[model samples]
Target chain A: MLFKGIAASHGIAIGPAFLLKVEELRHARRTLIDSSESEEEILRFRDAIISVKHDLENIADSMGDVVEGRQILEFLLLLLQDPTIKKEVENKIRCDKVNAEYAVSSTLLDVMDKFNIMKDPYIRERVADVKDVGRRIIEKLTGTEKDALNNLKQPVVLVARDLDPSETAGLKPGQVLAFVTDMGGKTSHTTILARALGIPAVVGLQKITVEIHPQDLIIVDGIHGCVIVNPTEKELSYYAEIREQFQEAESLLQQANPGPALTEDGVRYELAANIELPHEVEMVKSLAADGIGLFRTEFLRLIQEKGENEEDHFDIYNKMALDMLPKPVIIRTYDMGGDKFRTGLNSAREANPFLGYRAVRIGLDRPEEFSIQLRAILRASIHGNIKLMFPMVTHVEQLRSLLDLIKLVKNDLRVKAIPFDENMQVGIMVETPATVIALDLMLPYVDFVSIGTNDLTQYTLAVDRGNPKVAYLYDSFHPAVLRQIDTVVRLCHAQQKWVGVCGSMAANPLAVPLLIGFGVDELSVAPSLIPDVKKMIAVVTTHAAREMAEKSLSIETGLRVRALVHSYVIGKYPEILLDENDWKTGG
Target chain B: MIEKKITVPNKLGIHARPAALIVRAAVEFDCDVWVESPADKVNAKSIMGVMTLAASGGTLITVSAQGDQEETAVETVVEVIRSGFGEEMI
Candidate 1:
């Protein structure tokens, strides 16, 4: 049976599968004898660990440039220094006459068992890492070797619940046709590695392990989130046709690059990219973005260590701004709340964290802290076209308070004679229902506003998007959500403030017409989706979009509004319907 | 011995990491270090002592150290305060 899952990495191939099962561990409860043989065994085990360490260092030295290789080195170092492992070995040496090899193996098994039984998926995956390291050590100690996939002459599709960083590095790109995982997300290490390797992959397939059989003749369409298992002749023929069409479409899109994002009727739309990390600057450059629409600054502050101070933050912001110089980079100041900052920020423990002290609110509550960030932002503004934006503003007073704080910092800088761009444009994210409704009050205060549709939809619909049970209520096309977006867009445009949308919906082909119709100045989407969204925008007419936007805003029900907008767009542009089909089928 | 009272301007009080950053800065001077919050006082260099204060953002505390470097320690701690303990959120 065909199984569908989220496509994390893109590509396609057919190959035999190799399954690496978790090893069962048996503990050596017997006390070590003080005999000479036991002492010799201890010496052997110690030598084996030393050899394993040497092997790890060798691998690191050989593949030092690769991220996976670096990660293996990091894991090996952590294992070598783990106190528990040391304590276990010391106990065996003191109590049992067993050799070091047996003692180390026993300790490794204990650690693997402890990690394997963990309920957290992230922690549980560490068992695989432990095993990978332990296997190397055991091999070195026992001098017993088994063929480690080196003998598999045929190309194989690797299937796993998830591949640890170390395991992923050992995978030979030439021999591995594709990757299929039962669990992962877009940001998973496995997904990132697969994408980097340019191998086709599908992840978050909760049932892939149970459903897929050995050598099932599976076809994985990573782009479309479809997997075909034991396909019939008809399905096989259909997929071949689709594969050809997709290749042609991709080549056409490639040719269309570095061109104006203009419709056939000569309407131009600014295509921008939303970025979460500084590393994604390359992606923006590759996509040829007009600018970065929403540079989420929270990532810099969310590292495992202490949150970045003003200086560290300034360095990052300055680097990104200068790297993407000449292009207007709108950075949304730390939007830490919900699931994103739950563990990272100590202040994010409130019952209703989404509506609690976060974003500009946190900044306002603590002016000293707020000033540090403002100073960094204002300082970075001089390096490039750095525009500051506040997220989750529910009231006009909040914006006023935030603006006042910025002004104070600016004045302080002025007094201190620190050079700064006093005219740096400020903006607020129109994400909440309160903010959208109070657009008139908010319009005159900020230089610009970006509609963060993801949160706006969730807030307007009163739904917690992360909760799967209430996910159905998180529709962006719902009439109320559309109306809110339309209201803010219209208000911002009337006030002469260039309004943009930075959200998942902005990149959605179906929503492009409505956004354009609402007269949004810019549509910022994920860097990867820019070409497709631009392609759709090129086919759509501004006037038709405006009409559809009006109709959508007037509707009361989300389903009705969605149907009306979808039908109108499809009826006016038949090519869109075809694109929609292709999109659904992973075309 | 010199003692100067100062409020924690940073949002997350003298937490372990920030406390460590503060301790590193404080130990640069030769002085006996102690940070006293409203509830208790702790050795500025002791990570456990600093954490016990449970000082959060905006909590006022006094920093005192005794020795020849007392003046330098106090000045350094005050600088951290003035800089909001280098925390993004004060």
Candidate 2:
């Protein structure tokens, strides 16, 4: 049998299955003839709570001083001791004559229901924490809980309905051959942990746990997002070869050149990183990135209370600048609105939020709010090299007003006698067809431009990538999108301004050559992909890339264009396309 | 009994961390502590009760306590919430 899932991590694993089953606590309710039985039930509930508390304490102690681990454990421990939950659970046991497990589960249901209806999205998310605490108590009551993964006698393809953080925390590298889950997406904790451990994983399988027996032979093909249970001998031999090639690729990538990416013909291209949090600067530095090409400021919403204050922005930006000194840090001002941050007026009612009031529009309308960020960025400019950019600018008028706002912010700093970089570079994101056509007018006022290809594709094709019905139409490699990119590059080069592609397209191994061929000065990608992208850049020559881009430009369809690029890349670097994970099978 | 009205200073309002901080302080005194949002009131010693209060940033709440050291209990609990749970105030 074959099961398809999301290719969360890249690799393959073939081993007997190890199902991490979540024990269900099914208890029968019994009526108490005397008050003694009620007292006994209440005591049993207290004992379970105490045991769970010890379990949590042991876990927390093992975690040491990691702030997030400590905070999570602290929340769980507090929930375990919450007086309201304790009182309600005891009341149910005594009044309704239900077993300890039922009373605890039912009472938690009421608390979670109350939290589910909360107006604040953050509070609503905490319902998971409530559920987690309840599960621990029930497990203790039923005495059917243990870390099954910890007792693995041999490496196997671990299968589960879902692996929560607590279950995955004890996982060490090489402990399991692979992780296959019935739930999760690319950004889920399971995906993140699997990638971090360099383990092969396939998530969103829906029902792989039920299909496979306890010791069934399973082949987890994470690269293609599929799992084969009890493969034929012929299929096993074929995968064995592919697995060897993938291992060779993994080793090659490990030994890849850590220096700056330069073409064989000696042309250098800046390979930078796009980071969301301030602490991620460390990872960017470790990857030997050219600089931070895109520092998304949207994560600041988590602390929106302090986000409005100028000092809060200055402190974070100032530290980032100081740490990456000499290397340019391009901080994109708050890209709020849309699905994220619907806190403003009437955004919730918009039919087309992606095209509606968002990004620079919100920034321009609320100058008082906008200037606070501008003033902070300008003030932090002197601490280190800091470049400012605005997102979602469609016409020249928006560019003009944004430039005007920056000038006003600069003058405010001047009057206050605050030190700032007088020559800080300002750029704009060319994300829409209107911005691409008006690129000439906008380029003259800005120092540089970053093509946000993700938005450009959506806007260019008139399709929302999030909407599944027409998502197939949203392709960055379409002839129209490629032509637009060529025009933007040509326009920027004519004016001596450097252009960078800082979208998902920049990270694509196939798209790198075409972007370099277009004479794009920079390619800012995710921190993890910096090494792989840079390696690809090193193998391709400017002359060959130019030729490839020329041929790709005339290609009629995105699929054909992809095929052309694939052929060229497969010949140049077959290993780059192959998957990377452990070769657990001794070759 | 003693009571005092104070505004939640932290931008995130009384989230789990802030709720935990309030409960930790409330449990320190030998008194019955209670917090009252505009819509509801709950025992300050109960983490769930304080969290379910749903008081966001800039919300006005009343903290009250009775029994031994009632004034100290109300004042201490009120101070913790007003302190923004050590997070930066807006």
True contacts recovered per prediction = 0.00, 0.56
After superposition, candidate 2 runs with Cα above 4 Å error = A1-3, A8-222, A226-254, A304-307, A339-349, A578-587, B1-90
- RMSD value for candidate 1: 18.2
Find the 10 residues in a row with the least total lDDT in model 2 chain A: A578-587
lDDT of 1: 0.69
Evaluated on the second chain alone, the candidates' TM-scores are 0.86, 0.96
The 10-residue segment of model 2 chain B with minimum total lDDT is B81-90
lDDT of 2 by residue, B1-90 (tens): 899999999888987788888988998987899999999999998889998998999999999999999999998998888778888787
Q: Which ten residues in a row have the lowest lDDT in candidate 1 chain A?
A: A578-587
The candidate maximizing lDDT is 2
Report the lDDT tens digits of candidate 1 across residue range A284-321.
88768888998877656644155448888788788888
Task: State the DockQ of every prediction.
Answer: 0.02, 0.44
Question: Across residues A1-587, which tens digit of lDDT does each residue of candidate 2 receive?
Answer: 78887676778888888766534432333456667878887887898889999999999999987989988898888889988889998988888877677788878888999999988777788899998988888777655323546766788787877665535545655678888988765434466556545567898777777677666898888788889999999889988888888778776764576788888787878999887667678878877889999998865654555448878888999999998988999999987665444554444577777878899898888889889999989999996599999999988898899999999988888999999999999999988999999899889899999999877887898876544345446677888899999999999999999999988678676788899988889999777677788878887889989998999899888777777777777788876653221111100
Off by over 4 Å in 1: A6-224, A227-248, A303-306, A347-351, A565-587, B1-90
